[model samples]
Target: MEFGFARHMFVGALMCGAAAPALAQEANASGAATAASRADGGGIPDIVVTAQRRSQSLLSVPLAISALSDETLATKGISNSAALATAVPNLQVSSPYGSTQPNFSLRGISVANEFNANQASPVGVYIDDVYIAARTSHGMGLFDLDRVEVLRGPQGTLFGRNTTGGAINFITKGPKLKGTEGYLEAGYGNFDTFKVQGAVETTMVEDELGIRIAGNYEKGDGQFRNVAPGGRDPGGVDTWQGRASLRIRPGNGPLDIKIRAYAGQNRGTEAGIHGLEPFRTGLGFFEVNESRVGENQTDAWGVAANISLELSDAVTLTSITSYDGGKQNLQQSSDGAPIDVLNINWRSTFRQFSEEARLNYESDKLKLVGGVFYGWDRIVTDNSFYIGSVLAPGVDGGFFQHYRQTRRSYAAFLQGDYNLTDKLILTLGARYTADRGRYDDGYAYLFARSVTDPQTPIATTVPCAGAPGSCAYDPAAIFNLKGRNNALTGRVALSYTFDNGLLAYASYNRGYRSGAFNGGSYTSSSGINYVDPERVNAYELGLKGRALNNRMTFSAAGFYYDYTNQQVQDLRAGPVNILVNAPKAEVYGGEVEASLRIISALTLNASAGYLHARYKELALQGVNLAGNDLPFAPHWTAQAGIDWKIIDAGSDTVTFSPTINYFSRQYFSPFNSENAPGTGQINSELQQAGYAKVNASLIWVHDNLQLRGWINNAFNRKVYAYGLDLRGAGFPYNFLVPSTPRTYGVTARVSF
Candidate 1:
């Protein structure tokens, strides 16, 4: 099935490429201005990216990358993390804990359905060059940004930590030393949603120091309706975040420094889940019958400092230091039912510190970057689960699990690019990483109805130290475990630039992800056992260029990966979820993105992707999962959009932008079960069928003021963003999280 899809995509890409030049030529014959002459008018604007730790033109970089400017973000209505997938090809974001935590997957490489806050995602996320270590904090810091760059494939050399999938860099706007400037925006939308975002910047000292402050606040009544009697609706949105930045450059000298501090909190209702079983509820997809409504509360903050000094004409030294911490107290009804089948309260706190120093040297023929990094992080989790009402009808039963983990990482990396000739370059990079961690203070207590009290449940603690059948806990569980790993990873590539302004490249990379202890353990310590690290060897070929006098710009890439020891969360292991290693897997994909200026008043853009990811050798107990598709990996993804300048006048212009995105069928679990007897379905309920969404925006600019109206998911397509199988827990249903429905709003912004 996947092979045929790949062939069709390849043919379609070739046809599009063949037709673009003719259209551009026709536009040129109509006396349209060259793209370089009217770059800001309608042509595809040039983008500068820092994918290689240095500022370079996106078209010159020999890698698969997609960059979106702040203007594009607003025009496309991409306000949050999940919306990013709609714009970038082969990118997926799934959030089990609502908008608080999002797991990013690039090209079929992802963490699967692991809801543990302590585990780091294979896809590395960064903000202004500072790596975010915890997935809980990844959802924050999306507001008031300059640009977002998504680099596809393995980023093993410069970003050597856990970039087995890829990397996303969210570069925020900084303070400019040019007087005072600011912008303020406010909007109201459906579900009684109100939003306010703004940023202000000022110069503290002439040519020496500048300061910037930015913030975002949003509140809504929620979209999910609860149909159960006297049940309050869930899925509301209430969150606010703020950031402060300072930039210092004494006498406009080579000594540059930037310091930033940010904080945010979410106090909204928890995201609602839908049960797949017919007996659970007869409510609609957007209606839930949850009896116990919960709240999603989280507090996060971080501080970072970036310093750089020029030592010589060709040498520069840079240092980055950062500290981040967060706390989360979340209550959830996992069963999505009126009865107390599965209720959970999660309490976790995490802290991390990192320091990195690197030296960059640039000469006429060679460019080099070398760095050493040291990082430490700790997480403590105390979770309580209530399953008594479902397991034993009248008896109150539950368990409390407490665990703590401290991890340290050290690494040294070096990458250099040498110009073999005027148009040919050779790139080689390597890194050595050592990861060490200790998991301890892990224990669980099972409780039931007290003997003295019949109506109320009391603390009837039973530890795993008791005899067989005495407690519902695994006896062979190890409460304390230590793990260490040392490995080497690198990248090598050769790129050539044509005189016609085209860049072609081929490269190979080795990526690695550190082992981790499962933080979702509840019944037994064995659930928290150490899982080995995963590795991947990736190869890629790519092209980036322009056609028909630079009116059309495009990038294309094809890649393949040899994966081993992929970590996957196994929920079929009796009563407790375990982190197991998939012996082997294989992945291959291709993507093409292009933009063309049809005329001075219109620009058309499109992108398409095809991925094939499957496990080659995987078996658990007696069930074989070989040839099953990897989680969150869709076989096909596509997007088409247009930017039309319908009106243009002095100090006044109007633009209308519309986009459509599509995704093929994808599974959320690794099992990819073909039959679910409980639901009488031919396939697993944890899968989402192919779907498409439409988004559009209209903006009118008059002098320093701009007004805009936007809508997302205009067709109101019903789809699932995430899912979990509960059959192993003796439940006859699957928990599913739905994507946002149709939303519309209008906003006005004033700039100075």
Candidate 2:
């Protein structure tokens, strides 16, 4: 797939110059207005968002964004972060681990294969305006959310560093100074799955103080059937989370404060791997033969405070402070075979603290926002790999790696919007960021053991002094590494609003991501190399408006990216994965989203995306990767859905929703190797073919009580969430992580 610059420019020009008048004319038509009013009573409802650091209508925002409210989330079955891709155009989420540690890709920009605990993702994740430094913690606080906003393209101006792909903001519901309210929900599903969730809110003082508490718990029997003797299933779910929030108005003054605390834990098995080679056990699909069952044990907690003080009618000051920490003890069988080929054990702890302060000024013709931010994070990992057992019987060979990494970031940003005329607006913004990263206490060791007695090591080699054979030591690797980066990023945009309420915008933005040391080094000291930071220059044209007198809402955008020094994880270079930077690349994409209320009781929504991402210059291990497609970037993606209110009574209503999502064929590696480089045979496992999934739900509501029956992946499609090529490591098999199978459940809820 290829998209040229000439076509992009031509389309942009058309959107900017010709489309406005046509849209305005259509909106002014009397028949359209009458039809819209008769279709949905008042047309589509407006959603207020904070994409620009201020409250505004979603259609009024000049950027490409997709927002999902709490009601939408529940009806769509977006219970976790990975499911978000189904609703948003040009967005993809993947992880080596299932349902957790999600790595987001926006507009074909992403961290392709890096899974080290110390490395941060290029796609920034935020909770109530606080950045989450740890990737493993991104899955938390997904429950009881007010809305989730996905900002596409470069968010450098306001979001600051490490947001080259984009950003996801999860805003939770806060306590309201009103009457007492609460809700309780419970569900049961296949595989013996059980779930319970609830929330309670109360006003401690009339219009002065309010508090809210929420919790969720879920457990289930695993989906993957372990066929090996005495082997347990590995895809089960056992997790629980709790949160408490307090809001203060302080005598109904201008000072507003919100304090929130949350905690969660996951005690379940890891995702089962599926091998693609013939040498492994001949098991059926969704069946794994493994000697050791992996475990997924994690604990996370955080606290945050947001304070806002109104200085006057046109000026306000806001401060946000947060601290978060988590720990994980994970074990996985990498080869997916009954034989002990490769097993990994990881023990890690992470913590982060952040503070941000901003001031906003709004007037008739001008608006300004400025902020200063500081963040610090640290991660300590003790990881071990058990290898060489499959090739050589009666001998167990393994290696241990220990490292501690700390990072500090400081940034200052300012943005201003001025109305050039009654219908024209111009926006300018910039941010200066400085980052420091230190990798210390890094060392590794080699050990050998007899298979008969795996508990004791027969031979051990330690590389650092004071480090015993049992692998306990500090910063004595061969060298300690420190990286520093300073960058200036910004955005400029021009927008026009037509008389018929149509918005057209064009923008240019620059985005930057910090550099860091390779945390995946385990074989030798030379493997711990530093990768340079990446930068992107993006240009975009977009249009957002409501048509048919508000019964139809639509948004369209086209974007092009000039990317340099793109960071990637190269697994074919050696036995261990290495971080490297691709010198140059180009990406272009376009997306369209629309929703139409066909009638008062029926609505239709659909979205489609097209992407062209390719490397312009890259050569690794004598293989030229130029003109190859980037990993995890599909050329085409689309989704369609319908919401129909089939029945309505005096106080009772029933609705049915059905959706389908489609994805084109996509490569998992940059090589895109069809014949395994010089072998004329077919390597069909390198890519996933085009696929589609179907989901449906039926909901009934009666006053304060509700019931829902839902089914996901109704056809039980065979799909892989992640894949890795082990051929470079002298293995004939490739590792593939399969997605969840068909699931059906029924839920009931009561609200007071």
Candidate with top TM-score is: 1
What are the per-residue Cα lDDT tens digits for candidate 1 across 211-282?
999999999976788877886678888899999999999999999899999999888888878863653446
Q: Deviation in angstroms for 167 in model 1?
A: 0.7
Residue 746 of model 2: what lDDT?
98
Cα displacement (angstroms), candidate 2, residue 129, comes to 0.9
Q: What's model 2's TM-score?
A: 0.93
Which candidate number would show the highest lDDT if scored against the true structure? Answer: 1
- The stretch of ten residues in a row with the least summed lDDT in candidate 2 is 459-468
| Cα lDDT tens digits for candidate 2, 600-678 | 7899887778889999998754578899888788887777789899998878999999998877777777777644453
Give the runs in model 2 whose Cα sits over 4 Å from its true position.
1-24, 28-40, 276-282, 390-393, 450-478, 571-576, 674-684
lDDT of each: 0.82, 0.81
